[model samples]
Target chain A: MENTTSNQTAQNDLQVLRTSSLTGALERELEHLILTGELKPGERLNEIQLSSRFGTSRGPLREATRSLQAKGLVDAIRNRGVFVRSISPKEALEIYDIRAALFGLAGRLLTDMVTDAMLARLNEFLDEMDEIAQQRDFDRYYPVNLQFHDFLIRSTNSSMLAQEYKSLVNRLHLCRARGLVQAGGLAVSNHEHREMVDALASGNRERAQEAFFRHVERSKQRFTTTLEK
Target chain B: MENTTSNQTAQNDLQVLRTSSLTGALERELEHLILTGELKPGERLNEIQLSSRFGTSRGPLREATRSLQAKGLVDAIRNRGVFVRSISPKEALEIYDIRAALFGLAGRLLTDMVTDAMLARLNEFLDEMDEIAQQRDFDRYYPVNLQFHDFLIRSTNSSMLAQEYKSLVNRLHLCRARGLVQAGGLAVSNHEHREMVDALASGNRERAQEAFFRHVERSKQRFTTTLEK
Candidate 1:
């Protein structure tokens, strides 16, 4: 009886661990759906549908929705349920301004903190990005583009800043997905990334900061110009 | 029979609405508890205890916990339950750096956007803060101090920046409660607020930004110093 009870307790513990990991995975999938625009702006997310889609229970589904709501990716109504958040042009401009500040800070910190190995890694990433841009393989380039930003944030060794930056990037990604597709934007973004990497390699904090700002500003211009048209 | 059915429907709807609002309120309360350090760093939050204290159901309680986790104020451990996040000194420094970047952007935007009426309202807040400072009432000054920051954010008319700033403020507040209890630090902070308000009134963006940076820098210094001692 004692052995059987122990086995049952261990099984229950494993179930709890499995549930926690499942919740994390569910959160990521929902975030990706919003970021990729599968769930468009102001569209209500049906819990029953999402639950079946993820093969999760209502408890975890509701938890994931709450997480997204806090990230500003989703908004919950009292009776209606959660919906993807929509951004206005004005709010988009504000987002860019915030992005400029955040990325600029990251650049400055990256310059200060970049080791020889870090620079080499960045250079390696940039080389791959250049190849992707040359081939116009945006499908491959898009993920690399995200990795470059992620690299800067990670190199700062600041978890708090990284967390805040991740939230901003998620929102930006969602907004960017709604706009008209710009083929040239990727190449332009690559050029800016090269400039940023060069500034960091040279340890020029001011130049790095400026390059980072310009990068975000150019992307913002593209977004706004498209939005206007 | 019709009346009874309608009454039941109304009750159900009301329950849903009440739960939603209760979840929000619980989130705010839990946030305050974390920010004020009434809930100590790394302390576990029991679901049953929290539900009873907030006078809510487990559903709303779990929902509120999820929200707090998203804000980076809490962390969940499956069956073990949620715990308030502990910010290390290093994490605190990174937060201040981010704040400098964010508030500097806000200050620059405020200079470009500040109207005469907005300046007047800012001065009114300053005056009230000054009166409270003179009385050496830290408790009364705290809320006013927060209002001043909130006012700047709102004045910028950037919902995105405002949202990001709110998150930064929440994280910063988590690290500040203990450090802020020092008399000298509190006085210096009050003085800094006065200087920031003056800079804003003069429409000196550079000065305003500098004042804002110094304000955050001073707080960071105090917190680090207190931690060391």
Candidate 2:
């Protein structure tokens, strides 16, 4: 009887781990859908439909939705269901300002630590972005741009800063305003990226910081102008 | 027959609500204990003792512990149970960098929007810190110092930035290093506060941002110096 009880306990633990991992997988899948605009903002998360679509039970699905709600990627209403969070214009601008500070800090920290390999990686990003900009491909340019900034942030070796930056950027995706995507500003944005890369190469902290600061400021200006129009 | 079924459903809903609220309350209590250092870093949370101490059942207590783990306040091991998270020297310094960025952004944004009432509130914080510093009271000085920065962040009216800033500062509380607390540097810290307020009053964005950035840099320097010793 004692041996049987121990075996039961071990099985229960295994079941718990399996459920938790399932929940995590669902959460990531949902986050991808929501962030990429596939799920769209303010759309209610229908448990029945989602579970059927994913071929999973309701238990792990509900857990994943709860996790997204905790991350501020979704909103749960009393007696209602969870929905993808929608960011207001003002909130988006506020988030952009916070991102600017973080990006500037990344550039400043990178000034002292920028090695040959880091510069080579940044050069490759700029080249990829340049080709994309020439084609005026927003879809391709956008991801590369994200990757470029992500590389700089991760290179700073500050995990806390990188995590905070990523979280803000992820939430910014909920702002479905087409005007704020810097659509036609590709060449200009790439120009600014070049300036930032040049400053980083110069090993001047203030210059690198200002270049990054100005890039985000220009993007914010474009966003505001589009909103006004 | 329908009324009897509806009554049973109502009873179930009430039970669920009661359990949820109990979990939320327990989570807040646990957060308070952990953040205030009452629980201490790396100490395992004793579920039975905590539930008994709070007059709660183990069910809600376990739920609350899971919530805290999600919030990065605690770490749950496979078999050893959950323990309050400990911030390492490296992690603490990285968090400080992020907080500095958020704080500098707050100061820069406040430059354009500073009002007379905001100035009055800031003056109150400076005065409180000044008095505490003169008495060499680190215990009294610390909370006031936190409030001083918190007020500035809130006054900027950026909710996202304020939230990010608060989270970083809260995690820093997990670092139990005595050398990093700026115990004897209270007077110098207050002096920097005066400079920041002065810059904010002048309505120069660069000056305000620089003042805030440099103040944090000074504190980080103190931390590093102490760590080296």
Candidate 3:
């Protein structure tokens, strides 16, 4: 009897551990779906459907949904269930402004601390982007561009800034701005990247920050131009 | 018989509604306690103790904690339970940098859109802060200073940015750098604010943003000086 009770206690503890990790993982996965538009805005989060789809039960899924709601990526309605939040163009531009802020800080901090090796890595990215732009292959260029941005984001001294930067980038996916990156825009964008790299190479924090901020400003302008067309 | 069964279902739904709302409220209340440092960093979150203290049950307390854990404000270790996160000086400075970035963006956006009435309100704040600075009164200066900052934070076009700016301010409470504000520091701080407002009044986006960013940079420097002392 004593052994059975002890084993049952151990099982319960294991179950608790399993459930918590599952809840966290499920939360992230659901957020990815929502942000990437796999789950469209206004789509109801049906517990029964999601549970079978994710191969989980309602308990952890509900917890995940609550976390998503807390993050402002979803809205929970009484009896109606949760739905992904939609982004307006104005809000999208606002997100871009915030990204510009972080990216500018990243460049400033990077200028103060960037090593020769880091500079070489950035130069290599610029070279790759130049070739990709020549080909007018935006599809091929997109991931490399993301890599370059992520590299700069990580170059910051703070992990919190890096995490927040990535989160903002994820939020931008909801902006419906992907198809707006045209071949001509890619070349112009690459030129701005070249100017940003040159400023970083100069090791002037003010110049580097301005170059970075202006690049984002130009990108935002390009986005607005596309929206108008 | 049909009426009785339907009544039972209605009661069950009401119970579900009550429990979920209770959980959401508990999550926010617990986050408040954690962020405000009432629950000190590294202190374990005792489910039983918290539930009894909150006059609720263990189920809601545990769910609230999981949400907090997801937010990086708290941590859950298997069997040992949840503990609040401890922040370092470097991380605090990084948070400051991020805030500076946001503040600068707020200034840039505000410059493009601020009305005369908005400018008047900011000037009024400057006057209030000036009197407080003359007395070299740190306590009196703090709230007005916060009002000044909060005013700028809300001036942005994005509600999301405003929400994020406030969240970052709350996280700074973990730094334990409050008593470091001196009477002399108050006067010096208002001088920077003076320059920032003057630049804002110029209505040049670049100038306003630079002034705002530099003010935070000086504030960060002041924080470092206090830390060293």
Candidate 4:
């Protein structure tokens, strides 16, 4: 009886491991769909279609959806199914406010912990972004700009904070596709990015924090201008 | 052909919904387990034991674990089972840094949106905390202080920001159980809480933001001193 019970216990453990791995993969797939706009905001998730496409059963897929819901990527309604969360203009602006504070905290922490090598990496992006800005290459500047801000947060070495910041950036990216970079905005934005590097290099915690906080707030302003048109 | 396809789709949809709700309940139960210390930190989760205890299958249990993982309450290791994440003193301090920025953002946002009624509610808590502090009732002050911070975040009316703030608070709660409140810490903490309310009432955004930001930083400092012992 003891051997049989232990054997059954081992079998259950493997079953959980398999289900966990499946859930992880399905979560990523669903996140990609929502983030890329393939699923579209407010579009009801069709379990049958997704299950067939992914070649998985409904059990794992539903689990994945629940995970997405926890991440704020999807919302479930009573009696109705889950749908990709719709970000309102007002909501996007509010997210920007939260992001600004997170960036500021990143700056404060990074300034305290930054090494010469870290400064060098940041400056490299700073130089590249400056060149892209001068060339009025908005498209190229966008991705480089993302890397610069990302590096700033990651430099803090706080995995939890970095994870939270990335989630905010992902949601912001959805709203970003709606608006174009304003005229001369690339130069202005890159100018602030330079200021951020200088502050970090100066090792002044307050200055570094302010520089990052204002940068995101300015970006929010620029985004608002696009929405007003 | 269309009728058959639609009918089959409906069946799959119901299955998904049933699974989704089951996963939701399981997620909450698992969260409660981790938060309540019933499942100690770094303790490996026994899938068979949990499934049997909850009277559910592994599918929903695994999904719930995934959700908890997303929330940073659980850790999944390759070839090993899930365990309650142990927050070291260092990780706790790092989380506090993130929480500072979030609370600061809440203050800044709340200052802009603070109605007369909101101010009244905040002040009531402020007064209650003051009384508790004078009584040297640290135990009573703790829960009331938590409510004050929660109300500050919720006042922003940004569901996304509020959700993120709540998650940070939850993680910090795990760390909080370790350190005891220092002598007269409650009074000092409550003093800062009043300053936050004053800044909000004054309608000074910068002051409100700084007040809230520094409050969390000071709390971190207090937490660190305890950990050093």
List the global CA lDDT of all models: 0.79, 0.83, 0.81, 0.83
DockQ of each: 0.50, 0.32, 0.35, 0.33
Best model number under lDDT: 2
RMSD of each: 6.5, 7.5, 7.3, 9.2
Query: Lowest lDDT 10-mer window, candidate 2 chain B?
Result: B16-25
Clashes of 3: 0
lDDT of 4 by residue, A68-176 (tens): 8777788887458889887788889888888999999998888888899988888888789888888998889887877777777777888878888888877775663
Interface Cα root-mean-square deviation for all models: 2.5, 3.9, 3.6, 3.9
Measured with C-alpha atoms, the lDDT of residue A133 in candidate 1 is: 89
Candidate 4 achieves a global lDDT of: 0.83
lDDT of 1: 0.79
Question: DockQ-based ranking, best first?
Answer: 1, 3, 4, 2
lDDT of 1 by residue, B1-229 (tens): 9999999998985786676677787788888888877998889999998898877778888888899998889888876889998766677788888988888778767876778898788778877877877888888888888888888888887877787777877776666334663445556677787787778777886667657756776776776677776
- Which segments of model 2 are wrong by more than 4 Å? A1-20, A47-62, A178-180, B1-20, B46-63, B77-81, B178-180
Docking class of 2: acceptable
Pairs clashing in candidate 1?
none
Task: Give the per-residue lDDT of model 4 (tens digit) for B1-229.
Answer: 9999999998885676575576677778888887888888888888889999988888878878878887888888755889988888778888888889988888888888899998888889988988988999888988888888888887788887888888987787666346564544988888888888899999988788889999999988887777777
Better of 2 and 3 by DockQ: 3
A121 in model 3: Cα distance from truth in Å?
1.4
Candidate 3 residue-wise lDDT, A93-172, digit = tens: 88888989889988888898888998899999999999999998888998999899888888775898997887777766
